[model samples]
Target: MTLTKPQDLSTEAIATLIGKNARVYTTGDMLTQDFVPNRVNIELSDTREIVRVWLG
Candidate 1:
């Protein structure tokens, strides 16, 4: 993933955008019981139709 130039955007906006795709740990989220509200796990694989798993 590519990042934009953070020139005038606030930290909150940046963190929110990042949290949209990945996890973000902050003072408020970490302090409360909703630190990890969602799971951002991803499974990327190469284009292959093998019996098991084929990667290049």
Candidate 2:
């Protein structure tokens, strides 16, 4: 949930760290409105690079 230099981390790395609780996608990807308290959302760039990370 808490990562240092998260931008330096890859989506797969995050998935490995967070397990099944993570949702990795790009900025223009469609996402559901329903929020899961324990889920982690990872947003990526157009180039498929990680841009942001948050808890939902």
Candidate 3:
């Protein structure tokens, strides 16, 4: 996925795109512990827009 900063991709779209490259994908609030080690964790804004992407 050739993602650029501030891209207007939705959380679901980000998940699908990352899922294609990663073995697993997860989405949740920043305060939550919904993360899998060695997996991709996607953080989205309140409007469901991609805010951050990282490996847990």
The model with the greatest TM-score is 2
> If both were scored by lDDT, which would come out higher, candidate 2 or candidate 3?
2
Worst 10 residues of 1 by lDDT: 47-56
Give the Å error, residue 55, model 3: 0.1
For each candidate, give its TM-score against the true structure.
0.22, 0.66, 0.40
**Superposed model 1: Cα runs more than 4 Å off:** 1-7, 20-56
Query: How far in Å is the alpha carbon of 27 misplaced in model 3?
Result: 9.5
Q: Which run of 10 residues does model 2 get worst, by summed lDDT?
A: 2-11
**For model 2, what is the alpha-carbon lDDT of residue 3?**
50
Per-residue alpha-carbon lDDT of candidate 2 for residues 6-53, written as tens digits (9 for 90 to 100): 355465777788785788888999999999978889888876667888
Question: Scored by CA lDDT, what does every candidate get?
Answer: 0.33, 0.78, 0.53
Candidates 1 and 3 compared by TM-score, better number: 3
**Model 1 lDDT vs. the true structure?**
0.33
The digit string of per-residue lDDT tens for model 3 on 1-56 reads: 76455456544665677663332222553354655575665566655455666776
Winner on TM-score between 1 and 2 is 2
Number of backbone collisions per candidate, in order?
Answer: 0, 0, 1
